[model samples]
Target: MSEKTILVWFRNDLRIHDNEILLEAARKADKILPVYCFDPYYFKIAADGTPKTGALRARFLLESVADLRKNLQALGGELIIRIGNPAEVLPQLAEQYTVNEVYHHREVAYEETAISEEVETALWNLRLNLKHFIGHTLYHKEDLPFPIKDIPDSFAIFKKKVERDSNVRPCIGTPESIITPVITDAGELPTLTQLGLDEPVDDPRTRIKFKGGETEGLLRLEEYFANNNQIAPTKGRNGATVDRSSKLSPWLALGCISMRQVYWAVVKHEQANNVHNTGMLELELLWRDYFRFMFKKHGKQYFAADEQTENTSAEKQTLFEKWKTGNTGIPFIDASMHKLNATGYISNFSRQMVAGYLVRDLEVDWKKGAAYFEEKLIDYSPASNWGNWAFVAGLGHDPRDNKYFNLAKQASELDTNSEFISTWLPVEVAV
Candidate 1:
């Protein structure tokens, strides 16, 4: 009899730790062919006239894929690397390996789902199955109290219901050994130039230089919660506005670490330290789940601008260019943009401040700002990025139609000493 071969297609979920697809594939298949495809589609130009993946993000992704390959290799498996549409590449792989099924984690975004469908169709034509698993969210979709369509439109209400009715499922353990048939060539990782992009110069001023891979991600996670294993609100030096986040977003965004792994770590820390500081981190994870579910529910509507924001006037366009380039003339807004442009990262508060400034103060199209973010943010995930932007624009699940931030008031409270402002902005641009 032919060996039962299952092809595990790696997407956003890159790590082997606590990954459902890997666990299931290992359990069911006689041999597993791990694959990572650098789809040229993701490297193409977006509607915003920027490459869909920027240099920094592309660098992060390459590192992540390389790390996955290393980990799989350590486990006696090879991560098959290919560059093309998954529909075409996967079908060819299925035939070449005589694979019985293709397994992957399902994505919620329109384009991702479309690609899944295309791959599914292609696999169907070859008389093979494309099995999908849900492993991204902290809470499994099946465990939710309400159905996806019936989830409350208000985040507060949704949060309350989920916190009351649902529990985060325990993580699946990593496989001890993965079995794969030997293959001569698994393909090679691509360079930035090969992806039609220039290498980004490292900016020394950024607070944290994030390296991709599960090893680095797990190390950072431990370092963040090292103090008494307590996850509490952090403060910056001299109480200046700094990103006090765990810095796990880039890894989390790419699925280097599973949400459940992070959640369980927080729970363990909370239990060990006998502290209640798990609320902040858990709440953030819940918000991430909410955004992903919202994308699943609303589909493409999250990308739409409201009637009031339909304008493409030159003045608004000019303001958008300035806002994105860190020349908004408003000190706080400019500083935020500068930080984002320089490092491809910013604090959640800074993101809110800048998004509010763009939508409320500058009155530019929220979609444009979101598109620029899609191009720039190294940690950009479809649901979180677009969902937060929509929330700030008052177009997402919230009680308020529009939320406004007082720029002067925010700067006064967060950057009272202007230290953050000085760090990112030029002397002339500094207030």
Candidate 2:
């Protein structure tokens, strides 16, 4: 019998290191083919007719895929690119290659779950086995103490339980070697112009500066930790630069980098430098895991405005619009929205504040706000985006509804000199 070929379908998990699916495929198969699909459906307009993946996100995705292609090639594997529905395209590829099995990282979001199901069904028809590995979160889904059905209703309870008991598994390294296959024919990657997006022009004013890819992501992790010593800050008022934060979210969001790799790097940094802190960085990573666990428990309902109950009100819609267009009449909230719209990025603090303004003060549907973030944010992840929105809307794990920031209070606190607000919202506020 000829060597069995296993197809490793790259979705959100783009990096080679710490990728369980890729490593498992290499271990089990004589030959492995790496594949990535640029689903046109992602770029389609929603019912509201807005572009689903806006320019910033599309551009970042393009960069990430390009980087992944390079990384895979270095590992003696070709990154196959396809444009279409994966359910249709993947099965066809499997049939062509006589693939015995397909492996991929599991995704828990509604659309992702739907696609995974569809693709699995299609592959089953061809007698090819489908294998999925948990890789997006720091904590693997299967290792959790409680099953999906038993996931806690409150985040604090969930976090405390996991931190005390759950172990974050070590990172999975790449295979020592794999036989390079002969399949070289692959489709072209979509250009910004092809995707109906203008080339991204660099902005001189923006503070956040980086591009997509695992290499850049790793490099950033090194620089931020080494140069900044951000972990030393005890309070939020330490005057640390924005880069003090991990800056790994964008890469992690796209799966160009794995959370396991990030966790290990932070551990190594602390060990080497003898630096210690209140585990703020670890807490942030836990937040990421918490979102994934929440999605696992709630499924599609997590995307809904009321996962626990159904109580839609008219006032929520009104507030959602104000939040979307950055015209909420609150200077700080408006500035954060404008920054997100322009650059596809925002600080974590700003994200919470703006989300709160829409869900609590403006009384808008959380779905609309989450969808808008999905369209605009370069670092958008279905779990984090929807989970945070639900928290703000008082529909997720939060014990109580949080209040939106008072514009003057936040402006004075976060942007003491009004620098961040003025930079994004250059126009003077109306009296």
Candidate 3:
């Protein structure tokens, strides 16, 4: 909190603007040292034996990190890249620079919080402090009307209470320029294959060009509101077409853009134009915040399936394989699944449909489906991805527990011409 040196560790909150940790470190320090760790654990196998991260996500991450590094450099600071656990790396960096405190955005999930505790312990042993700031959510937890545990059981209740009781704080605390510290090595950025992943394949069927980083994120946001003139994706559980939807998740998941930034942007758009769905976009952000709060309140239990879950069995495995490959015989579900497989992206509407089909229709375990999405989605946020899959499978806080999607009815309503289905699944098959 003084004019001493501070170490700012970059995690998911990659951007410098609206980054409380970076702003505080810059304002209080004579020098700032920023670093990002490509955790080996992330690139390793997942709990379900699936690759923890695939080529698409790994590539997007690299692009995001590179953009962060360039942004920091432009501000006169350099991003020190490393490949290791943050628990080991941060402590060493603190010792190397004699940092007064380590600053970073807080991560609410069990595994991330565990790492935070470990790093805090390691820093305490070195006589340094590990300080965390709120950068992920639109409203900091302290600003919420109720405590995380007291969060409303349903999103409607939660959103209503939050809208009435809470305020979205304006983002305006960043330093104009970062003061650079003397350093010999800035470190190297790793390629996808260098990070133990295969190269990504280009699919001509994919729609949105999902480039990562804050620049792209902000530009895409501007385009969505101004040039694209797109509104709400849809009101139901069907895959949204790319031409009119906002493709902001890929950058958001990487922390290239803050939620508050997006929220305020929508506010401005609504004031300037008569966009009917501006509030709907903010509703999506609220849902994201809900999942994060749920993780905070329930911890690991938020992921435990409440229904009968078949995690491992021959029949389940076969069903999971068929589902993953997008050959489950159901044309609508298959189309959505194929869309997900071919591109590391899918609309929220289709996501629910496919997730529900895997759990209720095919009778496969929800964890398997969730794990596969974790591996595949380019915009995969642990809080959003796992929480949503759980919600679909009736494992999370769903008022309508054990809800099932009528796939045929959903496709008929959303994909009236069967455009989305035929585009993803061209071959006709008997169902």
Candidate 4:
């Protein structure tokens, strides 16, 4: 009889290093097969009737998967690409290959949970064990100070407690060696056209100058830290930008890169440079972990508006059109919104301000704003996007729920000289 094979199902957690699921599969099975499914449901029309994964995100995902396939091939394994539902597809593949176990990263959002449950049921019927591990976050879910149920409602409290008590474990390295399997064959990756998306032309004026993949992600980490020597501080909310901030979220969100590899890279850089700017980069990673933990705690309630508010349903989707089109009449917000519209990416500061305008000034529901972000951002993570949106809407972790920014005020403050605003916001304002 042949050795039982372990199938690694790739979702948002794309990389191989520090991946608990991948590591476990390597230990228990003689041969490992990695699979990523481009589920049609993800590309389906959203509630607003816009394609959930727009052209820009679809293009990035296609490139990211192509890169992953190359990486897996280099490691003596192959990344199998499939379409259709995971619940149906995984079982069929398992039966064909006689796979004994399946491994994957855990997801907490509503749609993801539904798909995961369906996949689990299918696996159970086939007598295959479905194993899941926490891999997307910097801090492991099991190591958190509080249990999921006990997680605090407020982010600051959670951040403070985690900062005081929790520690980020070092990243796990890749398998010493991987064994190639020849039992099954998979098809080539579908192009954007195959995925029902037109090829997106890259905008020349985009601020984000990176591509998708573990190789490119690591190269960026090396390049960014090599040139600048500043470190970010944890406390004081000083709002200082650091050259040390790893712009790995886009790849990390898509699972094209691993958080452990990022952590390891940061540790090596700190040691080599012998500089601790203020543990700011590490602190940001901790915040990333905190948002995931929050999602684990709140579940779908994170997507709803507070029922106790009298004006809940009265909130109209007024500012969304302007915000989405980047013509909110406010220069900074307009610029950021326009930038995101054209390039499918925006800086973190701009993200918060534009989100603030929609939720606070325009009085739109945060979910609508979040859904729009979901449609546009290349780095869109349910945990981070919704978590941050809820925080800005005064619904998630902020103590002061009334966080609104006067667009003009923000324009003067962040772009006092008006250079940042003028770059995106045109001199001739649309009437």
lDDT of each: 0.83, 0.77, 0.80, 0.73
Clashing pairs in 2: 316-363, 316-364
How many pairs in model 2 have backbone atoms within 3 A of each other, for residues 3 or more apart or on separate chains, i.e. clashes?
A: 2
Candidate 2 to truth, TM: 0.89
lDDT of 2 by residue, 1-431 (tens): 78979999999987888888888888888998888998877888887678889988998888889998888888777788988899999998887877889998888888899899999999999888889878899888778888888988666777888878788899888876655467758768889778766665544467777688888888877776776555554334434223256667899898887888888887887798787652767777888888888888878766455644423555655566667777777876877777787678887778888877676776565677788999989998988888887776667656362322222233435543334444344333346
Task: Give the Å error, residue 137, model 4.
Answer: 1.8
Candidate 4 lDDT over residue span 245-322, tens digit each: 456678878876676666767778778878765365666676677778777877877645566343444225445666
* Best candidate, lDDT: 1
Cα-based TM-score, every candidate: 0.93, 0.89, 0.91, 0.87
lDDT of 1 by residue, 343-409 (tens): 7888777788888889888888788888888878889998988888888887765627322222344
* Candidate achieving higher lDDT, 1 or 4: 1
Error in Å for residue 328 of model 2: 2.9
Clashes of each: 0, 2, 2, 2
User: Which ten contiguous residues of candidate 3 have the minimum total lDDT?
Assistant: 401-410
Q: Is candidate 3 or candidate 4 better by lDDT?
A: 3
1-431: candidate 3 lDDT, tens digit per residue: 54588999999988878888888887788999999999888889765666888888888889899999999989888999999998999898887877788888889888789988998998999988888787888888999999887998777788889999999999856678888678778899998877888776666666666877888888888888876447744343445333345678888888898899998898888777755567657767888898899888889888565657456878878888888887787776777777777678887878888888888887787777888898889899989988888887767766363222223344445553333455354333336
Best by TM-score: 1
CA deviation > 4 Å runs, candidate 2: 233-243, 303-322, 401-411, 416-431
